[model samples]
Target: MKRENLLVLLAGICTGLAALALTMLGNPANMGFCIACFERDIAGAVGLHSAAKVQYVRPEIIGLVLGSAVTALIAGEWKARSGSSPALRFVLGAFAMIGALAFLGCPLRMVIRLGGGDLNAVVGLIGFALGIFIGTRFVRRGFTLQRSYPARRTDGAVLPIIMLGLLVLFVAAPAIFRLSTEGPGSKHAPFFLALAIALVIGALAQRSRLCMVGGLRDTMMFGDAHLLWGFAAIFVTVLVGNLILHKFSLGFGAQPVAHSSHLWNLLGMTLCGWACVLLGGCPLRQLILAGEGNGDCAVTVLGMIVGAALAHNFALAGNPDSVNEAGELVVGGISMAGKIAVLLGLAVVLAVSVFNSRLGAKKNG
Candidate 1:
């Protein structure tokens, strides 16, 4: 096996093990790492939204950015660049978050949910692939977001510096943050420990260039399974770990932090998958790129944070299935508003894809 592929496989193994460890140590079930969920929690903690139950500064996020930044610097791979449709990228980022929240997780978490045997994630996986397939069609037709230019080192360091401040606030000035007393936000592994694990995962991901969206996109576009190997390793590792730990529950209902709204699950992920393709990376990949001094990706990350805030504020996020006081299964899903938002997201992304494609530009010219 090539060294790069092996590194990716190792990264996947470590990621899966980290997720399992964090869960055992008190993070939400099948939620050892979720870029969307953690970012949403960070938004709430910083008063971006009023979601009381999901407010906290997740150290894993802080660690991921910092870890990647540090690793890039050490590897001499850090370079500052920006200016490729920043405004559009930000909007796309927002819509991506909106879609992911509508489905209750990002692509990474979707895979993790699958490892834990959630059948709903299987539905999400199908939709995600379909979305990627649609995006690839545009790519084959010469879809392009244009080129980015070189930037100042400080511009690239902005996100890392911000993450450092957040870490300080998380560790030193916790009183200023609105910590969740209950719900998923309240459930977490130890702060330093989670941070430490995430730092390692970030370093590994940076080295291996691990990305779930890239895995599917590359396979479709170039018949390359190089990136997919990492996710495959992750799935196998998590599946074994869950089974050994008795955390594997194969069913559609009663899963933690998930809904049985199969249609929304499919559509939401479809939107997320499509938007990420246009953005040129998944949420996790965006974070890693931002850390490596891509100012445009940093903007996208900021947009995702705000998008998460807006989701909760506007009731666009999905609700999980729950048992009611009457001892009956109460189905949980997105509201009409959320449904509209997802459909709107799809329309907006489609428009972006068309306008950005070379064929569309040529026809207009």
Candidate 2:
């Protein structure tokens, strides 16, 4: 195997193991790492919303950014760049978050849920692939967000510095942050331990350029499975680990942090997949890129944070399935507001894709 492919596979293995270990240590089931969920928690912690149950700054996020920054610097890969449709990217980022929250997990978490045998995630995967397929059509028609330019090092450093400050706030002044007394926010592995594991994974991801969206995107657009290998490795590793640990349960209902609304699961991830394609990366990729001094990605990350705040404030996030008073399953799903948001997001993304395409440009010209 090529060295780069091998590195990505290794990164996948490490990520799988890290997720399992974090769950065993204290993180939520099948939620050892979720960029969207963690960011939502961070937003709540910072008082961006009034979600009392999901408020707390996650250390994994802090570690992921810092780890990528340090790794990029060491590898001489860090460079400050920005200016490719910043405003549009921000809107894309927001919609992307909304979709992920509507589905209740990012692509990475979707894979993790699959590993844990959640049939609901299978529906999500189908939706995500369909979205990617749609996005690829736009790409084939010459969709372009235009070019970015180099900037001062300080511009790139801003995100890393902010991540550092968040770390400080998490560690030095925990009292000031609105920590969750219950729910996903309250569940976590040890702070330093989660940070340390995430740092290692971040370094590996940075070196390997691992991304879930890139995996499928490359396969459809270029017929390359190079990036997909990493996710494959992650799935195999997690599947094996879950089985051995007896954490694997195959079913459509009663999964942790997930709802059984198949239609929304499909549509929500479709929105996420399409938005990430236009943004040129997934949420995880955005964070890694931000760490590598991409100012545009940093803005996208901030937009995601804000989107998380909006999700809870507007009651647009999905709810997990629950057992009701009669001891029967109550299928949880997003509200009508969430449904409208996803549809609107799809319309907006479609518009962006069309206007940014060569065909659209020719018509305008």
Candidate 3:
């Protein structure tokens, strides 16, 4: 294998292994490392949202930001930058999380879910690809977010430092810090072990710039499957690891913490996929970029946290038995989460059309 390919493969393996370790250590089923879910949990932990069921300080997420920061700084890639449609990126980030919660996973978790034999993730992946395909159409039509310029040093350091503070909180395990007594937030691996695994994965992801969105987008826009291969490795590694650990359960129904609503899964991930493409990376990529001093991505990350909070507060987030009960508004046996995805997808596409018109008017003027 080529050296670069080897690096990417190693990164994927690292992530897959970390996910397995987390699951074995007591993280929720098929939820070893989910950007959207973890952020929602963090939102709950910080009292941003009052969903008592999913509140915890996810150390892996904090580790991801800090590890990326450490790697970026060591590699001298930590130049602070911002101002590339920050507002729009923030909105897209929010929408991305909205859809992800509806589907109950991000792209990475989607892959891991598939590896664990959740056929529901298959539909989600299809929706993800469809969304990416549509977004690529916008790209072909000259959709642009302009450019990011240099910014202050503090702009880049803020999130990393905040993450470090979170790490301290995790260690302190203070009673006043609002942690989940039950649900996914309560399920976690050994604190230090999970943190160490997360740090390794985050460092590797930062170094390799691992992103499932970019991989799929590149494969679609070009014939390059190079990036896609790394993700494929992740899927296979996770699958094999799950099998060896007796964690692999094959079926569409009876999946842990998942709904059987296929259409909604497709729709939710569609929103996430389109927003990811528009923002130029997945949520994981945004975290890595934020770690590397991208203030715009940091703002985007902030948007995701807010989005998670809103999802929980509004009951927009889905769970295993919530398809017909207790989440968002259920209409005639259907949850409003799917409707939200459709509306969000439409709204974002409409925004793109408006941008296109403005650009055209400028050209004519």
Candidate 4:
């Protein structure tokens, strides 16, 4: 393999190891790092969710954005710009988190879930791929965001600094933030250890542009599995790590903070998959891209924070025991309504994009 490919492979291994170690240390199984879940916890810390059992200011997320920023600054990759369909990207981010929560994990969690023997993750992965395929179709049809212009350095760096501030606060005031009483937040690696792992993963992910959603999308659309190779490495490494840590629990009868509803696992990830496609990357990808001064992604991250708070305030978030009042099993409930809303919203946005693109083409002609 080429040197660049080799770097990506190593990076993927580190990603898996970091996640596995987090789980082995006490995080929910296969849930070492979930973008949506962590954001939800953060939301609760700031009073977004009153769910006392699931509240904490997560430092990993803060490290992700700030770590990427540091990489970009050192590499001279930071460039502030916006106007890439900002509102649309925001909507996509919100929906992506919603979908991820429904499945109880992000793409990273999906693979880790698989490693830990959660068969439902297989369905979620498939659904995620299908969602990406749908988004790819739109891309083929000329789906594109608007161009972005350069902005001030502060405009780009502000969010990262803010994230860093949050991290400092977390380290100083874990009690005020409200660590989980009985959930994933309660079970954690030591503060410095978790921070170190997150920092390493964040730096590597920043360099590799490794996104779980983007990996499969690249393969299906461009016939390039370079990104997928990273994931493959992650899977193998994490599986081995799980074995060594005795975290390998075969057959998922009742996994921690996970549900057994296969259909929801599939559908939720489908929505998340599609949203990631539309937004141009997954949650992790958005953070990395934002660090590189992609203002559009920055806006999307803001949308996710907002959406997470909304999810909990509105009783949309699930508990650590995998019990969501709005789960797929709840017919004629809020979850169903949320699903319908997401589908219709996406359809409307897509139709508008198509119509606007055609009109612009005609005018130019």
Candidate 5:
């Protein structure tokens, strides 16, 4: 195999092993590596959301940022840059969170779910693929967030600093930052182990550019299956690992941390997939870029944090059986508020895709 293929394969193996380790050691089932879910929990930990059951500053998340930063710096790949439309990316980040929470996972987690034999994630995977496909249409039409520019080195180190601060807070047992008393927030692998695994996974991912959205998009658009190899590795490794460990169980019902609303799973991920493609990267990519000093990506990360807080406050998130703010929006076993949120997201994504497109700029010129 070529060197690039080897690196991506290594990255995928690292992702699967890390995810499986976290789960086996006590992280939530089918959720050893969900950026959105972890962010929502972090929001709760910081009192951004008062959802007490989900409050905890995840060490893995902090590790991801710092680890990526260290790796990029070591590899001489670190670059501080920004300039893409910050506000639009922020809103898109929020909507992306809304959609992920509705689906109960992000693209990575969707794959993880599939590896664990949750068929519902199959529905979600379809939706996510469709969303990326739609976003490709926008890409073909010249959708652009504009160019990024160089920035100070300090900008690149911000995420690592913040992550270190959070770690310090955790150590000091600060009352200011809420630590969970129970629920998913309370369950965790050994902190040091989780951190180490995240560091390894983040470093590898940074180097390999492991992105599910890019993987699918490239395959669909360019017939290039290079990115797919990483995903395939992740799936195959996790599937085999789960089977060997007796963690594999086929079916939609009784899947841990997952709901049975198949359509919502599909639609929610669709919104997420479409938004990620238009944003120029997935949530994982955003985090990695932020570590390398991309201010725009950092802004998008902040948007996701805020979106997580808002999702819980507005009763837009879902649990094992139902979504919050249950009412007329519920249809096809999915909430109506959820439905409208997705529709609005689609409109915003479409609007951005068209209006900010290079085609529009050319027309004006």
Candidate 6:
């Protein structure tokens, strides 16, 4: 097998193992390594949310950055660079996290949720695909971020070291950042187990360049199938694992930290989907790409942090019982605003794509 193919295979396996560990450790089945949810929980740990039950610094996230950094360094893949519409990317990142939180998970989680038999994930998945399609249209136009410039080596290393620092903090202040007393944080696999799984996944993912955005982008842009194959592999692995563990459950009421509002599910993931497209990668892809020295990805990571902070501060996030003021859990589903935002966002993305494409055509002509 070619080296790239081997790496992709390893990536699929690692992702599967991570998902399985998440289920075994007591997260919702097939919910292992949800980039969005885990990050939101981390946001809560630093007091981003008043939701006490959800607060805790997840080791997997910290491990992902450091692990990817380690792999990139060993493989000579690290490169420090910047200047890809930094401000726009940052906004996209922030909104992406918001959308993901709204939906209760990222693209990775959407797929994994389906693996666990949550039909709600199907809505989210469709929304995500639609958003990516819209973003792809933008790409077909001349909508392009400016090229990045090389940065100082230390600048490249700084973010990864900070991630390492977080790992140490997890060790020194385990009690302070103690796994949640209840809720998702409360139900984690052992620290070392989580760390090991995260490290392996991070490394493999870095090598494979696995990304949810890329999955759709490739299919639309070039009719490529390799990245899609990796996604399929992960879905298959998680599905089988859920079956084997008997953790698969059908139906949607009273699931942990998930709401029944189908509109919000679609809207939330749509936000995440659009933002991921604009920023050029999903949250996990952002993390791995950042480790490989893509400063734009790092900016998106910062956007996620800020977005988390804002969500908690503004009461945008939903608890297990209910949503915020503007976010009502109506009888049929989520409120009208939720549905409108998805439409509006898509409209804006489409307009941008059309405008940019016309400009590009003129320039070429």
| lDDT, candidate 5, 1-365, per-residue tens | 88888898999888988889899998988888889889999999999999888888888888888888889989998898877788989999998888888888888888888999988889989999999999998787777787788877777566777888888988788677887888888888888899898988889889998888889999888998788888888888888889999999998775777777887888888999999998878888888888877888888888988988987777677666433475322222346766777778778877877787766458546
Writing each residue's lDDT as its tens digit, candidate 6 over 1-365 gives 67765667668766976888766886654568788777777877766566666677777887788789889989998999887677767767777877776777789887787777777788888888877877777777666655688987766666577677777887887666635687776667677778778888889888898887788788888997577766776777888888888877766654445666777888778778876877778899999988887777888887787776666566565444344488754323333444454455456545545665576666767
Off by over 4 Å in 6: 1-3, 175-179, 319-365
Q: Single out the weakest 10-residue window by summed lDDT for candidate 4.
A: 328-337
Per-residue lDDT tens digits for candidate 1, residues 181-289, read 9999999999999999999988999899999999999999999999999889888888999999999999988789999999999999999999999888899999999
lDDT of the candidates, in the order given: 0.92, 0.93, 0.83, 0.75, 0.84, 0.74
Runs with alpha carbons beyond 4 Å of true place in candidate 2:
359-365
Candidate 1: lDDT of 233? 85
lDDT of 2 by residue, 1-365 (tens): 99989999999999999999999989999999899999999999999998998998898888889999999999999999998889999999999999999999999999899999999999999999999999989987878777789999998888899999999877888999999999999999999999999999889999999999999999999999899998898888889999999999999998999999999999999999999998898898999999999999999999999989999999999999999999899999999999999999999999999889965467546
Model 1 — which ten-residue stretch has the worst lDDT? Answer: 356-365
RMSD of each: 1.5, 1.4, 3.5, 3.6, 3.5, 4.0
Candidate 5 local lDDT, residue 159: 71
Pairs of residues at least 3 apart in sequence or in different chains that clash in candidate 1: none
Q: Which portions of model 4 show Cα errors greater than 4 Å?
A: 172-176, 318-365
Question: What's the lDDT of the predicted structure labeled candidate 2?
Answer: 0.93
CA lDDT of 7 in candidate 3? 84
After superposition, the stretches of candidate 5 with alpha carbons farther than 4 Å from their true spots are: 322-334, 358-365
Record all residue pairs in model 2 with backbone atoms less than 3 Å apart, i.e. clashing. Answer: none
Rate residue 29 of model 5 by lDDT. 84
